[model samples]
Target chain A: MEDVTTLTKIQLDALREVGNIGSGNAASALAQFLNRKIDMAVPTATILDFKDIPTILGGPSTLVMGIFLKVLGEISGRFLLLIPAQTSIKLLRTLIPGCEIDDPLNMGEMESSCMREVGNILAGAFLNALSALTQTPMLNSLPSMTYDMAGAMIDNVIAEMTAVSDKVLMIETSFIESEEDLKIHIFLLPEPKSLMLLLHKIGVN
Target chain B: MSVVIPVGMGELKVARSPETLVVYGIGSCIIVSLYDTKSKVGGIAHIMLPDSSGIAKERLNPNKFADTAIPALYDAIKGESGVFKANLHAKIIGGSEMFPPTEDYENNIGRDNTAAVKIALKKMGFPLIAEDTGGKRGRSIEFVLESGLIMLSILGEEPREL
Candidate 1:
């Protein structure tokens, strides 16, 4: 089994470009949804060990709101959108701006569904860009929303990959809405087979 | 002084009295905590898969699979902690169906993992004293060796001792 850490710089750069184009489209879609300007940091593509996953999200036990979806069809993988609890509330508020809710924490089912819808839109936008760029036909499973500890939520996603590889290829982009403290991370975790296919598409052996 | 040992995914840890074995963020994966009251020794394994037979090659991590992990945990406790098999009790946590169930049973990893752990426990002759498994939520668990208490905390719920 080849180690992901052994990926050449060119392969890593190719992955980073994929993240950039995908997140760029996602940012535009989010900006339209919120009717506000959005700023995105340069996307980062790196390989992480199983234990390093939680630390990147915050900590093993930190509570986070995540949206999970499985990518089917040509490029099989997983997509996740994660934000801190408070930031998630901010996202919920952005969706339902008219509602006079003081604390985002004190939200209800309506808010939760709204968050799921937002996740669907963002993930869809990102995948569309990726499909176009790589010319790979990809479909996504229904997105599921979860408010849980970062460690647990992320652990489930990467569990299957553990048997195949010790390291995971994680591409992430952080974006923020204008004049709000809300920050969200868009994560793409492609399966090993899918990753190799992507690398091959990008002309890396 | 009490020590808190964290059991990472596919990893196992063994600790003595005055210490706690903890694993956080148990989604579809399960954490098997074994403790011997007589010796005040405990070990925790964060298992991601049910069986090792499905894997392609010889993997180094025995703790990643339930069938391998159960015997490994028993050996670690007995050899290093000097605890006999008869004195060891088990507490299982996690194995949450984080996503909705799919038509393919093989894809339903949470349910599969729970079943595998149960089978392993039965085969090893170690009684399952308590369990907090098969839920839609994730859990963080702590096993305190001194009191043989397992503390479980859900996201929006209060922490409880089992």
Candidate 2:
């Protein structure tokens, strides 16, 4: 794998373009689901080297929504959605309208269903975009959900990816939908040799 | 008067009045509550890990680990209002398996935290009155001081008395 510092400019541009398309597709799908106009804006993509994940995420408090996609015969990573606790609750309420929670909140079937559907939609859209850009057939695994302290989440993701691939590249993006801003982080993990193959395909290295 | 004691990570709070002791955002952490009806006193400890013996030996705060926090909670309630008894009722919440993969590291923390609390309570001769735990979600718990009632709320579930 090339030094992460060297690929910043190129990777950032590629990721931003990819995010723009993916976010657009997701917004359309969500809008249809809600039967209302869902405005989504994709901000510039930020590159987070695996080592700097904690710093990029700020404090140890983070709500993560991760999506895993298999692209180019390799299982790459994508953080299709991420938000703070405060934002997550608000988004949950927005997605499931009129869901009233009492003092001691317990998640019921309706709320779980809503979150799962949202994860599926976001992961589907993002994977589709990634496949089209890479000119490779991509398949996505079932979406899994979890929440944790930011540091623990980042550490777990990195550790898990490293066990599978030699190097992992992450693409980070921010989105504003229905006046709610959220973070979307996508990870691309390729074995060293596979990464070289991908770069050759893209005419990069 | 209803006083609200918000317990953070590695912290414990005790109240004697008809107050509510709560802990929020309990992801992969344990929230243990000890209530004594005779004195109308309750104590809560929000612990992050199962045991303190392995990691960060220097940062040994009794309230930070289930092993130590459980004992500290008992002592605090006893010392504060003479409510410590082996038969004190206990209710626990917020040990959620909030990770996607079953074998993943993130998933183990909650399990470990829950196991530690259970062990500690058993060793101290305390019986668990009620519990709501082990799910892929977050929880907020409130211990009503007057009635020693434990109420648990998960993200999408209805609030129920434990």
Candidate 3:
């Protein structure tokens, strides 16, 4: 019945290192894909109570676009890349020039598929890095896109995690592209057991 | 004085007349709201999972699962206002499959949650009066205690009363 909030300083530092490695790989991948300079903040890994999750990502009612992928293999979990609606449109514009970014909900199937691919590429980059660092084999499912309230989307992640623990372990990193005025967040929610496996691998109890 | 009571995950609350009960960030999770029109008293449970069986809990968190939450809601409404179970009506909302399924991940938890909530309510003999469930969008719900009116709002969409 240990909550994620009780992680000792050493554990937090270890997790932050993992976050840095994973997001570092992801940022480079995105930068290459967009063909632009991308800057990322220092990654943070922390355990938070379930109820506080909604408020952390700009409150419960904030509208956002989420790209989700399920990670499978040695370490199973979920990965998410979330951007504001405006950021998503800008991303679309950058990815497919002349493609209409207006109407976040209404988009061609081809455009939607492009977004999905963007998710796959970004999620793959982070998972690959984590997999390499932990020496754990990991694979991801095809990416899926949804536009909704950020709180509601996070509820799905929390619901999946509840079977194992009431606490959620989150690795969050924010990145920005100066050319497009785009700001996006990358999140990793490793299963509680898988997280322990990671901590054990890193020599933390 | 009318107070806005916020119901977070795995939580439930009861409010009297003129007070409002609200639950936010309901995606795939179900919100079961019970109200008694005569007494102007109501309760809302934010249920995260469908079933509670096989889980070890040192303390019973009734609001965390549909199976336990509905009966708890029935008792709370009845105990606080002397309202009969028959007089109570249920409105369910926020079981949205927020994302499409991938090759390996089948995102059907929203349907599972709605079904479980239906079964739980049926077993408790509480009739369901309204529901807004099963979509790709997330929803927020507001229940007014004065008239038992439920307001459902999807982001970027106009709010509707049910």
Candidate 4:
């Protein structure tokens, strides 16, 4: 189940469909909150070697802002929202007036909670779409926020995740805020067994 | 000028004098650095899991698990320099708990990894010299064989040698 090669074209397409709907909903949610337009690139679901993951968000040393959530319930996995450092600062300033962007490394309670709230909203929308589409029940843990090197922020999850399966099914979606093209990447990594169950639920199995 | 070799996840590498080993962006993963001071030779491993027990063997790279990677790394370093056992010493780094403890399945993999690396090193008879671990930050490290010094770099903090 960890091997993407075992997944047929139909199954992959179905997974992509999941990403599309999920991200599409998430994008609209953000757009409404910001009172503007947001665009999402075509979502992709790919099976990746654990090593290549760091390169996905620039590199292992690339510093960024990350919000993590553990999906809870029958179809369980992990959810991640990654925003590049500069973009995170800009978004934070926009959300909370007078919020400091000068130091991307330091964040007060207000800033951290703001980011966490946004994370819950976006992740909520995405998961809600998945639940509706598959008629499955699931929820997410309270959001945890951190700013650090991309590999450091993510490798731990990959370690815990890949222990069972060497491969990861990354359903990724990129949100582009049409005006400035601020980009945010959302990733949903399904546990091995959960992925199989998801495919079956979506009629792909 | 020494050439630096980068060790990625689940990878193990050995080098001689003037060569350095680096592991980038380690969180919850443990970096085990072993050096033979006499020969100025070194080995590094980026171990992702505590051990390989109960994990399926198919496609399992032994180098990623602490229990397996330590012995294999020691052997490789020993073969590289033909150094005797006494000269080898170990320094470990990067076991930051990325998230606070959650459900047991999502508990502190970083803590588990650090403990596992310690047990493996002890059983193999390598003297543990120094260590920097257990925080809530990500780190990148470079190991210099010539001096057996490790330059530990954390995001938004000053780099220190261990």
Candidate 5:
């Protein structure tokens, strides 16, 4: 059994570098779509244990949109983008300038559509970066949205990944531009039987 | 007058007035709504986790988790200027998987939360009036104060009243 604690460090550096590249691409995409200057900062990367997710993100509450993807033939994972409710509303208003939404509690169809598009752009950029780094083809699943009670969200992801792979690697990144704060969490879970194959391909084992 | 009692995770709110009680973003958590038409009173609780024992000692705020929150909800509704027993009605929504690939933790939390709620409600002598639970989606629930109608919106699903 590999030490899960230490295992994250080995890939942490590489994931951070990838995040830098991915953020740049995503910023460009958003800027082009919104027709405005979108300033984004490359976030410091960290590895979060399943237990610490809630505290790391602020509270035991989260709103997430995730997309699953199969990459490098042997590795399968998901790209998750998260924002707190306050930040989501702020970002949405910015993205949809001149739209007046009175109730912050109400999420109308237009807001949902905008969020979905944002999900698509972020997922596309992140996956493209992964493909380039690994020199592998990637296939994507439709994006889905959810709000979770903090730690439960990460716990669910770990539990689900364990069924397919004994170990799961999580890469964490954040985005902040002006007043918007967005966090992106990525996971790479290789099926148990395919673990060795992936390790060999990455020259890790 | 409409009194909007916002039930945060693991918290419950009850009002005697004909006011709407709402709980937002009930993702994997469960929202329990009880109403008494005769008394013209209603309440809602949003429970986050299945058990309070597993939570930190400081988080014992009944409004933050399922196990602790349900009991608090009962006390709030039944203890004070609450409703008469004969006029009470109940409904529940939200308790969804939300995440598919992570069936163990993500999916099970919703189920566990619902079970805990049912057990608590049964023990409290409150029968379920209606329920919309279980799926791979999140929901927002509102309990109409005057009519005691529960309105829910689930992702990709039509908005409905129970």
Candidate 6:
């Protein structure tokens, strides 16, 4: 019912702050899991209408392994973890020692589930941060992994979002391990109602 | 060389000959393509949702839903280029699973969109010709007006015609 495209500068800053804290937690968890130092860029937000939503997280058609987790309960939305095809090999190796996916496109079930596990850890950490801050109980669905064009991987998610809201608020944080040429993008998209509730909880309303 | 135009989600594009209309990275969303053989009036719509039933009227875009996009694309093609409805053949592409069937089985928006688009086209009396739908792969399609071919390309796969 509210217009997200018209979010004020303060709202934008609040959203960025939310992304920053959540991603910070996820980044630390990833670093600890991988036993390496991972540098994360400051989180940023991309709020756009459905007409422009498909073009982000890289051009729509860029080959990617999209890992998704549905956030449920007190606050709801989706968490999309995008690991580009080029990063999957290195990422898998780090996530699961000696278990790297040679061909991301033709991944086996084991390989796919491994990616989902990665999604679980990252999204869990991010959601934990929100839950802790808000003192609300929230749960995430089982992680789902798909290998496809970025546009294709995300269209259905966008479709569901559009059924209720005109715009999508994507809070993106990039984890860069430059030495390994490994970078992952985590996008947090909260439903509009949940977003309002979240902002209210964070004292930005 | 002919110009290539990119169509984004919840939008539609119509152009004449020597031009191509492309919608990139179609997953779970459906792309409705309409082209006239004689007039070379080509159009492509990247529709996100199946319908706009409960959507608010003020912010609604006709091109965002299959139920509305089909008629809008038809009217746009005719209005912009004066092509007859009978001259336009319809092709549908891109209705991919966002998750494996094992996961989000009940809520495959891609499947719903494909079905919705088909129903809308049938209701509008458009002759449906070709389609590429329902798979795990995402597609990027190019609708070339010069030849009226929908070049549908998926990752790790060769481009194919719809």
lDDT of 6 at B156: 73
lDDT, candidate 6, A79-195, per-residue tens: 889898888877776666677468797677777777888889999999899888878887888888887777777776667776656677889899997478678999888877777
Please write out the lDDT profile of model 2 over residues B20-106, one tens digit for every residue: 887655666678998888888889997766776744545356776789899999888888655759548888886665555523332
* Better by TM-score, candidate 4 or 3: 4
TM-score, candidate number 6: 0.93
Q: Which stretches of candidate 3 lie over 4 Å from their true place?
A: A1-6, B104-107, B155-158
Question: Per-residue lDDT for A80 in model 3?
Answer: 86
Instruction: Give TM per candidate.
Output: 0.94, 0.54, 0.94, 0.97, 0.53, 0.93
Tell me the lDDT of candidate 4. 0.88
Order candidates by lDDT, high to low: 4, 3, 1, 6, 2, 5
Q: Give TM-scores of the second chain, every candidate.
A: 0.93, 0.91, 0.93, 0.94, 0.85, 0.94
Please identify model 6 stretches exceeding 4 Å from their true place.
Answer: A164-166, B80-82, B101-106
Identify the leading candidate in terms of TM-score: 4
Candidate 3: how many backbone clashes? 0
Stretches of candidate 4 off by over 4 Å are A2-4, B102-105
Scored by lDDT, the top model is 4
Give candidate 1's whole-model lDDT: 0.84
Docking class for model 3 is medium
**Compared with the true structure, what per-residue lDDT tens digits does model 5 show for residues B1-162?**
566776654456787656777765555667887777777777787666666664446524555455566667766777656467666666778667665532222236678878888887787777797898887666677778777787876544688989
Q: Model 4, range B1-162, lDDT digits (tens) per residue?
A: 999999998889999879889888999899999888888989999999997998777777789899999999987887874677899999999889776654556578899899999999999999999999989999999998888899999987899999
Better of 2 and 6 by lDDT: 6
**Best by the DockQ measure:** 3
lDDT of 1 by residue, B100-121 (tens): 5433433767878999999999
Give the per-residue lDDT of model 3 (tens digit) for A1-205.
2356667889889989988988898889999998889999998988887888889999988888889888898678888888888888888887897897696787788778888998898888888898888888889988878888888998787786775466788889999887667898988887776767788877888
Which of the two candidates, 4 or 6, achieves a greater TM-score against the reference?
Answer: 4
Residues A74-128, model 5: lDDT tens digits: 4555556665566566657778978666433466778766776777777677667
CAPRI band for model 1: medium
Which residue pairs in candidate 5 collide? A60-A150, A156-B106, A160-B102, B10-B63, B10-B64, B10-B65, B11-B63
**Clashes by residue pair, model 6:** A60-A151, A152-B25, A152-B26, A152-B27
